[model samples]
Target chain A: MRNSIDTGAVICSVFAAVALFGAGSLLALMGYLVLKGLWPPMRALAALIFAHSGDSLLSIWIRSLFLLLAATLLALPLAIGTGIYLSEYTRQNRARELILSNIAGLGEMPPVVYGLVGWGALAPYFGEDRQTLVIVLTASVWLLPQLIVAAYWALQEIPVSFRRDSLALGATRWQTIRWTLMPYSGRLLAAKTLEGMARVGGEAAPVIMVAAAWPDSSKQPLHILPYYLYRSLIEAVDPATTRHFGAALLLVLTSVCFQWAALRLRRTGVVAGDTLPGLRKR
Target chain B: MRDSKLVVRNLSVYYGDFQALRSINLSIPLGAATAVIGSSGAGKSSLLRALCRMNELWDNVRTEGQVLLDGQEIYGPDVDVTEVRRRVSLIARHPYPFPKSIFDNVAYGPRLHGIKDKRKLDEIVKRSLKQAGLWNEVKDRLQESALNLSPGEKARLCIARSIAVEPEVLLIDDPTYHLDPVSAAKVEDVILELKQKYTLVFATNSMQQAGRVSDYVAFLSEGALVEFGPTSEVFARPKDRRTEDYITGRFS
Candidate 1:
């Protein structure tokens, strides 16, 4: 009675095939990027990740990492605090409902719109210091909704019984969060942080508005890689496409590494909550 | 009144429009196991949760009249809910272990109470686990993840976690409801042992379970108290026909 296959299976399979096709294109793009990164004119594939025209590739990367990390750190507490308040403190009502819905909607907004807003509002406040400040502010706002949403869902996924249990043990609301809920959700928190960084790596529009005035070769020590690649493709000043490919490849490699670390963290929980059956052996 | 650890006078609870508990009056004696028995949706859990103000965790839940613990009114405005919970702890229906090693889970309560001295915490964890009857089994693996323990062991570990806080009253809500028989028996035994040191109020639907673990019994039906008396007297001679019928299996 339970395992019978039916027309539903065939219908779902058709959609699965379509989804798989979409994934295949993404894989093809990645392979192409890798090929471009590794091939001849790019010779020292080492040069791609290590050094680029005029600037140390490592410096470019370190700057990008700093922006992403700083922005994420800025957003982390605010987002996690929002999540905790929503999950434990606030009562369910029209206001809470509105806030949650708005957060979800924020995730759907265009990144370029954020770029425009950053250009207009933040451009003046930070004069020569504009690029770093703008990127940090834009990246934080862009990432806030995502991390909070992930946190909200993560807190929800944690059994409510855990909260009750903590309280019953004489813990205050803050204690319940610090001792019980936070530890239980460590993996989720880590994964979402990585996801946020990858998003910053991939999004170039916001970075363009902030850094366009500064030449890529100026080595002002700031970046959003996709935008730099875009500049390389369009501007005649940099005829060699290899550098763009190299940078793009480095970006991909870093994201892949972060995802790998996240996966490993999930497989072996940093704290002692239950794990998936597949992860039990590890 | 002085002897009763908790006294509920004209108490009523509501969730928005619907009243979950009608005006009810009962008293729980000090340092004894008082079991509130009723069918599902019978307000047994509502009564237990109200004892420690655990109901505050949810939305739109409101309480009327007085729930006096010792002598202080728990539901009164301006009374800190955290202090009340420290005095009155609840062990929910199912096992819930924090995402930590077994030792850390038990140590969480003491650490919360500001017992930062490593030696003091170690002692508390050991005593609590031993009292919960789990120290021997888990001693070798105190640092092991609490999640890896069997379901029965986790339930006991939760009890150890609660006792480590040194609460004055223990509210056990359906102690063994979802557990296997052996686990249920073990949890029942732990509750029995617990009442020796802490005043306990247990909520359960099964009459037989109430008989096994309670020193006093409070029978509730349709959000109202049907009967309240000592376990021996309540089970032996019920003044209310509903209580009698329920105990005799004539009705639930």
Candidate 2:
């Protein structure tokens, strides 16, 4: 009773089911972590992320937060600018294709590759331990491709006619971009920036390889949440060991909070899949 | 109106390896509404863009011609495309208001030209909106987002936005094509009103609209100027067969 058309439909349905199951499995994993995470004591969690005295969790959390902020400030403008140039200025061609392909390749490259690159690049000028500002900068560079892709897509979603319309109305090309494209794409760019924050915020491998342990005593950087989690789990005594789980909970919560902020932004019509009051009617 | 004369001599346009418009000669008088009517691919839009130097925006589009606005060459080396466009604004086939409040959309062009006085800007916004016939509907809600307007209102808003800058000429490319008959009629009325202050050059497929609003008619075919005269004379007795064919609906 399987007609030729029905066979294709059956195959497509099986593929769709597989895709859904894969998505559901990831969702379930995050859901489980969040469910278990809320049960921990907030005091312990705070101590884990904030306390700095002698292997205290707070110091480690602060280190990670510092690194994340440093990376964000350094990386966002370059990444967003690259995305804009590629999406707006460059005509479609081989060079554009090659750049996009490289961005995709860089996005998937292992965190350890960036760690190694950071180590080599920073060792001579900064030092060997990848744990300071250098490592954070490196990790952000690693995360740059993702931010650019997101920003590019957001910019692309704005119709070309919008730019042309403004220019036709006697606005300079830059003026048109500033007044029209930038304001419209503002939410999307912010969302993309938040995504970059989350990516750097959650990562552990690059942070571990590049970040230095506490008390170089002169210049200490790159001791972030993930690195803190690793350091506490491996180096701390049993009494202090509870901090690792707490740090894990903190990192997860930070990422979740970042995502929640992005979602809230989207809901408030600051990001993609939302429309601003300026563009909804016609 | 002293800058009334626009002279085009030996204008030719090419798209990559293909020629789109042959040697073309045309003149437009200031303060008169000229209607360019032709079939698709007749290079009507190309000619309009050429006048504004917007054709230069396309990499593959090459023009070898002289377009002079008030005896000064528009395509000359020293001419600023931005300055030319500031004097001669264009309305696209589709209407797109800037992504801003109705008041801000009207305020954009003036702001760009460094008109920082908010009160003067407000007056310009209101007056422009009034001239475009959108003031009565949107006056109270000027600060509200422009995206909330109906399609006709949005198109009028675009016109109002252009008028805010007080351009010398307004080049409208088929503003009513996508509109329903009623909205199209309303827009046409706005155009008729607008022709008093600005030199209006409008492209359209509708012969009826051309007859109604145009002071002069220039019929084009295959990228060549076929016939042109006062609107009343051309429509009543079109000299060219192509113009006759187009007017009678025998062919595009």
DockQ, computed on Cα atoms, for candidate 1: 0.68
Residues A143-235, candidate 2, lDDT per residue (tens digit)?
788778877776776766677777777777778767777777777677767867887778877756555323343343545678766766677
Query: Model 1 chain B — which ten-residue stretch has the worst lDDT?
Result: B91-100
Worst 10 residues of 2 chain A by lDDT: A273-282
What is the overall TM-score of model 1 with all chains considered together?
A: 0.88
- Tens-digit lDDT track of model 1 for A1-282: 334566678879999999998978767767887777666665565755566554555667777788788999999999999988887777778998899999978966888877876776776566555577777888888889888887886676666667778788778888888877787677777887787678766788887776644444353645456766666677757564567777777677778778878677666654334432322100
- Could you estimate the TM-score for every candidate? 0.88, 0.87
* Local accuracy of candidate 2 as per-residue lDDT tens digits, B163-244: 8888988989897967988999999999999889888999998889999999988898888888878899999999988889
- Candidate 2 i-RMS: 1.9
* CAPRI rating of model 2: medium
Clashing residue pairs in candidate 1, if any?
Answer: none
**Model 2 ranges with Cα > 4 A deviation:** A1-54, A128-131, A211-220, A234-240, A266-282, B1-4
